[model samples]
Target chain A: MQREHEPNEHAHHGPDKPTYNLVFVALTVLMLLSVGTAYIELPDILHYGILLTLMSVKVGLVVAYYMHLKYDNPLFTWVFILPVLMGLAVVLSLQGLAGY
Target chain B: MNAAHTSVHGAEHGHGHSISNEQHNHMLKFGWWLYIASEVMIFSSLIAVFMLAKRLYPAEEEHLVLPLVAFNTFLLLTSSWMVVRGLVSIQRGDQVGLQRALMITVILGSIFLGIQIYEYNEFTHHGVTLTSSMYGSAFYIMTGFHGFHVFIGVLWALWAFFKALNGHYTAENNIGIELFGLYWHFVDVVWVVLFTLIYVM
Candidate 1:
């Protein structure tokens, strides 16, 4: 078998074309779902929940697959996720304090 | 020593390679992620402020042209996928494939930026300037920052493309391309949040 010439990170190839295609499909679906929620007349909580959940998932998919975080060392994932989570926590706390 | 460094070490444990190429690349990758983390902090702060502004002013979403922005979002998402494909191509040692993929990514990112410029023009024409209203200001700040990031990513993509054209990245030393992929995907992820908060909500 022909070996890879100069594979980066010690020749550990990340996700392939098929995985990328799958991720693309998933992102589009979640996006459409979010857009659908926007048009439909739903309860505030329900609409917010759907949109937030789908947005998070879509972001997760991009970070995990497209960013190749899932394939890399776990540190990069935490490094990327921690700040956003910390900010979310702060925002939620502030919202709670404000009686939101 | 560390799991993250294991790949670097495992490849060249005692060959002084640790002091050389592979380890250096891994460190560069990690440092780039740290930079991205800092970027996340900056964006999160802006997002918190936007949330507060949004609560006060409440965005007038009726004026938002969802179709165009939605297509733009799709364009970014697809462009991210293309970046991944480009990385995969180099991993398979196909330099031409990588160049083609980067060219695609550059095209998609450029189009996204163009649409953003057009959208800004439309919003301004419709009386939504940065200083017009609190929500308008916040909207511009958030989306403007993202647009700036996209512009940088586009320039970065062009640079990476030329590098690919010059045969800089190979299957073994393609960390530069990987780093580009990470930055591009981070831009995409940020858009996912902004699109929901600014437009859909």
Candidate 2:
């Protein structure tokens, strides 16, 4: 009964198990790429720019898929993302205030 | 002909029921996500403080060991994958698989903490203690708190593993495991930022 129940549930709501494996592979590859990027001798600003971009992508993938935010209700996304947006504002404001 | 149409309609009904169940699961996940968002606020404050201290004492970067930190990053990332695999296993009704994956995750988390202890010891040898300067304080507070979270996550995963041993979770009902994955993944995400800021930058 449980096995029968899962296919229907997954078909209705979520990705298959194979997709999770694919996502895992993608995450690992991205992690390696980020670490590799760190060693490259680009100018400081551009180097950080690439690293931050990669980091954001990794975060997005984990939150959206691994955390099921992508398939979940939009309200959950808003609930989680709003505070993060607020946090970003605080960081930026503090950076400005600190004369950075 | 009528029987064929009735069977088709029943199939649609089954799909509808499945969707409702899926939505119920999402509602539970929403509550967990809200808790995670609160966690985000806590970490954000610590991160802001760390940034301020870094600005004040820019030369503290010399005390950080980037290669070891990167290796630790790999450990956490691997553990995150294991937890996700654990969730996938339980979702498929594979109790043994779930337990195995979660056990690996716990082990990886422990090793990550061990490496952290080693790093802290190294830092102490290099004259970087919590009271050494504002930079030292911020570094310890941020990374130490993250390490604490990893500690809690390892314990949480162990509990989940035991629960799996008792067959407490099923494909239709595994909110406990799912919530654990969410928390673990959040911890990993926090480390991603902390690693970049504290070590790389």
- Candidate achieving the largest lDDT: 1
TM-score: model 1, chain A:
0.80
DockQ of each: 0.55, 0.44
Top-DockQ structure, candidate number: 1
Candidate 2 positional error at B10, Å: 26
* Cα lDDT of model 1 by residue, B62-179, tens digit: 5788989999999999899888888888887889989998999889999999999999899888888899887788789989999999999999999999989999998877888888
Which window of ten consecutive residues has the lowest lDDT sum in model 1 chain B? B1-10
lDDT of 2: 0.81
TM-score of chain B, per candidate?
Answer: 0.89, 0.87
* Model 1 error, position B201 (Å): 1.7
Q: Model 2: residues >4 Å from true position, as ranges?
A: A1-12, B1-24
Model 1 has a clash total of 4
